[model samples]
Target chain A: MRFRGRALKAYVVASLAVLALHYIVPYTVLHRAEGFTLYAFWSILAAAWVVATVVFVSWGWLER
Target chain B: MVRTIAEFLATLVIYIAVGTAIALVSRRFGVKTSSEYFVAGYRLGGFLSSMTYAATTYSAFMMIGLVGFAYATGVGALGFELAYLLATLALLTVLAPRVWLMARERGWVSPTEMLSDLYGTNALGHLVAVLYLVALIPYISAQMIGVGSIFEGLGAGFGTGIAVAAALSLTWVVVAGVWSVASTDAYQGLWMITAALTYVLWVTLFLVPSAGLDIGRVAEAITKAGVSGLGGFWTPTTFTAFTVPWLFFAVTNPQVVQRVFMPANERSLKRLIQYFAIYAIIYTLIVTLVGLTARALTEVGVLGYISNRDLVTPTLLLAAHPALASFIYVSIVAAAISTSNSIVLSVTSSFVRDLYERRAREVRPRRSITLANSVVASLVATSAVVAFLRPGFVVEMSVLSSVILLPLAPVTIAGWVSEGVRGVARYSSLVAVVVGVSTALYSAAAYGPKKAFITTWFGVPISVWVLALSTLIVVAGLLLSRVKPHVGR
Candidate 1:
């Protein structure tokens, strides 16, 4: 009853996606690019969080 | 002494200014009900929640112990910060929603009360209360040492006494009270970003190009200075430290319990999580870079690498620009005050708000508890003094606190995981605490210090590994508890 089946799965998926990006996005900025490394890294990191939220909210169903 | 004077006065100003802002807002915006006082009336938006969480989470240590760790250890120290990435996101997805739901449903305002109120058991709740108090005292001591250290380091101009500075800080805490603490947190949170960004920019413009420092050059300086000169910083090292312990703070912390009450709904909760994580990641990365820049500048022959790692950033600022250093100095104090006040308010809430009020049950007037709250504040102060007197005692105690909190992970899991959990989860968490503490003490005695044998899978501290195993045992016990059929329903 507590699981909320699809909802919990969606939550887990979003979290993993964000953490996964956290691990790699830094590497991409540090190794893959030349200009604006810090800014790139910062924007990407913040955006991953944004994307994660989108990933999470996409799972919501209309209650009314 | 002048340094201490400047630091103390600056800290006092920031605290008063920020504290008053919180109080005014709380009253003006209508924190009329107990929920508002206790949990900001559960009306917090994502932005406020994110800032408060960061302010409460960072504390004096981020400026001191954390920066110090980076100063000494290099980027390899970042494992701690990185862990927070994993932790905070998890808290949003998992922990906060449950805590809010339970608190609202049962009106269970405190962690200790939630146990008995929701579960209908007093012994389990009381046991948790004891554990919480034990875990928090050293945390408070960590902040005390932060205040005391600033006092000792500054040394001349302000005519400040350690007791005087400490008292002034505690008074600021009493002023905004809890609401004030939150308000100040929002302000301090902004201050932290500004300080971090300013340091990054200042060092980049002044130190980096002039000294011919680049990423490779930074790495080279770190390598040449070896562990001793470079202070052992490397990029990976800095990232780890920032992430790890923060995971605990963001996800599992009882301190952030009130945060859950603030968000308007599930949608807001998700947004707050993302906001805090992104901000923390960005801010931490900047701090890590700034720390590396400090190493490079020192190695490139501009400044000296001071003995205390945390002092490196502030010390560097002091050497570079006195006027700018003053702001950083005050911000550091603000950071400390914001964090310490959060802890103080948290401990006070659990003690005076939960333990005291629950026993009385009758709608005890808020004013009646003022004296008790004062006593609790004094108790935290006394423990801090004791730690200051023998810092070694606090260091040992913090190691012990790590051991103590390990059990809570399972205890909380049980509370969330099962409706018919019964006594098994409760006893498991308590047992784990005792076992983990005993083992941690033995390990500390055996290994001495700074030699925690980290495991590969989690790289969790040895004490935490002990906790993980204990939690597993609790899980098994949980299974057993549920497996057994109830005789009467």
Candidate 2:
């Protein structure tokens, strides 16, 4: 009956962090570095979602 | 753009021949019952499920619309698209299992039917079915429009393009329902990704460098272009307005929600989410990079600045080898047809399973399948005509489909998280959805779709307004139900 779990918590935190970075970094630290720097940074962040997806599935968070 | 009519025609003919062969072969698996016809009897393997999901959800928008958006707006388009990818990944992780479990347990075929079951009313299901028709027709038509434009760009005649795309979608879905659609989607998905990878490599290796720029120089040029760089059009308000609706797309879009019901088991569902995420991120990068490369070329004066963003990819095609351009063009056509096929199948299933079956005393599987195929045909014809007409409101409606469908998010979330959400609570939630949709329509009409989406009341975008209003109504209904026992179903 309980829904809370470590993996779920980690997944939520990771997703929120990525979203925060998307909104914040572009206008803040990376604002002036909007060239390849911004592109590389965002690409890596986007790739992180795939890594998160792998972990979420492998760790059974979906089952939880 | 160089007109490669002969090459394009040849590639398109071969693509259709191969796709039709796949669809016809898929019928060997057979579709005898309503469930089998609509959802492949919940027997789609992991690979097929994932591939179909990717193909259906991405659409021509990724290559054509999204590439143009990035070319015109800058790297902000990457953020917008990636946000959608991330949200979809998160939502799939949390909700896919629950939805799949319920579908299997209850023998539900349509998303609306699941909602109707939750509220214990056929009326809500019927209402949602109607809403799907209104919201999705323009979206389907938009796919036809995209195909027509690509055909016109290639010197193939617009009307011929629309008819070809419409005929393919109709034939695919009607052949063996989901089986045929998914089978061909798997083929088309491969073509789409392969074409994308090829195009990106060519641009990065040849196109960019031949323009006297490397990745570094292109990056520098993009950054130097002030308004079209880093955060150009992606202001906080603009980003929020465009992204918030897509964040809930996993649940709000019934076409994808129905996909959640197709995986045969838990492992298939897991694979579905996992594979789709990988495909999505890779495809997302390929698209945005192409757009960025186009923008970079424009910066160096190798390519002219294109006011009409959609023409960016077509213009790029002029520089590509005719063979490569032909492949990419057919791939874009494949994207359109695959998307339209899935939408037609999903929407038809919604109409037949949710609305039609409810009124009949006993369900005849054969009759239901017949009616579903007929509806699929009718919907495709209607969408094709609309695409040909190219009404002003069609684009508005297409743009607003996500916003109009946004109200379904709160209703769906409540159904999933709560038990016995019936009677007045459910009724009030339905009313909330209606109100949200009406608000979206009025704003789009009053201020235009583009402006209406970004326009705000008290600093909140229209998307947020719709979501907040619907959520509030559902909450009030739940509270009212608690206070009065008789109001509970």
* C-alpha positional error of residue B224 in candidate 1 after TM-score superposition, expressed in Å: 5.0
The Cα error of candidate 1 at residue B435, in Å, is 2.7
lDDT of each: 0.59, 0.85
lDDT score, residue B20, model 2? 90
lDDT of 2 by residue, B153-193 (tens): 77778999999989999998988899999999999999999
Q: For candidate 1, write residues B1-489 as lDDT tens digits.
A: 366456556655665565566656655555333455556656667677778787877766665666666557654444345546554666555656666566666765556566565445666567666666666676666666666666566663222333543564466455545465566677878887787778778788776777776767766675555522212233433344234334455424566755666665655665566667766776776776676667667777877767768688657665555546656665666676666666666556566555566676575455534644585568657755765574565755653454456556655655664665565655665566567556555655676423332322255456456656766766776776773322101
Can you tell me which runs of candidate 1 are displaced by over 4 Å?
A: A1-7, A10-64, B1-15, B21-25, B29-35, B156-165, B214-216, B223-246, B387-390, B441-461, B483-489
How big is the positional error of residue A48 in model 1, measured in Å on the Cα after superposition? 3.1
Stretch of 10 with least lDDT, candidate 1 chain B: B227-236
